[model samples]
Target: MGQQEWMTKDFYAILGVDKSADAQAIKKAYRKLARTYHPDHNAQNPQAEERFKEIGEAYAVLSDAEKRRQYDAIRAMAGGGARFSAGPGGPGGSGSFDDVFASMFGGATGRGGAGFGNGSFRFTSPGGSGGFEDVMSGLFGAGSRGGFGGFGQQPQRGGDLTSSTRLSFRQAIEGATLKLRVEGREMTVRVPAGVRDGQQLRLRGKGRQVPGGQPGDLLLTVEVAPHPVYSRSGEADLIADIPISIGEAVAGGSVEVPLLDGSSARIKIPAGTSSGMKLRLKGKGVRSSGKRRAGDLYARVRIVVPRKPSRDVTDAARRIDEAADFDPREGLTTQAGW
Candidate 1:
């Protein structure tokens, strides 16, 4: 949808739910409205189709957790609803809504009246006509003005802080807590289990101080270190290599395998299991918060040959070769055009 719709639509009202509704509640409302007003379901009613599209657009923004938060913040800044400027020849000057607002609230009377900075607005005083109080009261209304005193009295949320955290391969898979040092303060943060590398963690009310407002959050970007023996695929699966002796490969047995959680588990190897064989251990891999089911761990077998053999072993090998008379390269010459 266009920017105007974003500023005008009350998504919570359209979905028939409160602003405090959780993600599931929002989803349920959207689905119900969407199905009832679907284009196919109301082919003869153009209004139903339009309403369906509007509901879909609203749901698209409000259903997502992150996007919903941002939308709510913007809406709050607009005082529950946004203000639009009349078109050309309207009461205000000929310009965009933002431009008109800037002209009216953009001077020292407002803050320094300079203009908008970053994501905030600043106001300045007029030439030499009136005092700070007079100009501020005139611009921002009597209850709250825009001067040093007024600004100091206003409640403004603290600025958000950003940081980076690094975790070991196993920690990334199993999750970990980190002690972070931000702005000369030490804080402990819990990194959710199964967090992937490069994911961001947000800690609420953990930022710079604000005059009369609550503190903002701290945003941490996670970096996962590589493992010596294991590799990750997607968010859950793990791959590793397992070495087996020649005797074990032929005889089959149970072996102790290291897990990502720093523990060990017994893995069974079937008799006559060959080199390059793969074994899967269920529910032993990474866990994901988004999905219900856990992933599996895959181990690839590598058979190791002995560098030296005893006389009896050599003799037994020779006898076995003679008895089998096997030719592993029998078709290589023909295939290679030798």
Candidate 2:
């Protein structure tokens, strides 16, 4: 919305929240009211739909830290919900809103200068600097010399945009070219390999088009999906569980392990290897980057025993257990008074 419209709105009151409400409290109020008056929940009810829109508009402005500050400033300047008119005596006859701005920006007074005409007003300071558009650009965070177009409640300057995309686990490890819908337009983006979850990327000059100045940037966030077989750790290290038979753990030897590249590699399993032992395979994880070296893959050992063994196998196990005479939990109840 434009500056003029913003001055007339009571966003705090619309959301049924006090001016001192915190972000969390404001969010809670918005969610509760949105659920109650949403169009999906109250179909064919115009009043409910309008209420839902108002709630959304209020949240859109209040949820943003910068937008909320600007809105609050404008509301305060207008004496808390003041209506702007073409003539003098704004809101409760304090003075014309234009006159207030003219005095602040050092613009000329009376009609034909910072005055209203044809349902619109203009504020032009000396040397074309410190005008209403310049003040608005600063408030809206548009860069220097990047004032908004059509200051008389017209189209605004382009602002930075934000978006997020989801990537599969493999795609996160291996870079992929994706086409994403941003600002209602499909654009191609290249995601680097080994991108961690919640990483943000910035693209310059890819935001909304402005009338005169350069376009703003697009901030993209990446979300990596979980992998069923493998997971990541540290900067680029990968982890996986490798199941080995009990016999292999007892008499360890060379075994083939799976890799993310649809291949397998043989690694030696030390004799007398136990369950939960980790074996590191160098250069088997993520690719090398300028900032980070190539990572290693950790294979955690899991000893698997036979289920429902045959009679002969059961007899052999019983004999072996008797010969070993081993107590796995030797501490028993003496430890920790358990």
Best by TM-score: 2
List candidate 1 stretches off by more than 4 Å.
1-155, 290-292, 307-338
Candidate 2: where is the Cα deviation over 4 Å?
Answer: 1-133, 139-141, 144-157, 332-337
Native-referenced Cα lDDT, model 1: 0.64
TM-scores across all candidates? 0.50, 0.60
Q: State, as a TM-score between 0 and 1, how close model 1 is to the true structure.
A: 0.50
- Tens-digit lDDT string for candidate 2 (290-315): 54567999998889888878998888
Taken over the whole model, the C-alpha lDDT of each candidate is 0.64, 0.68
What is the C-alpha lDDT profile of model 1 across 1-338, one tens digit per residue?
Answer: 33334445798999999988987787677666766876657879989867865675576567557657656654553563333323222233223334433544453122223233433333322332234343323332232223332243333455456555668887777667778776568988877778876565677887656566677677665667777778886768887789998668867998878987678888899987888797898888878766677888888788886679889888877885687688757999899998
Clashes per candidate, residues 3 or more apart or on different chains: 15, 0
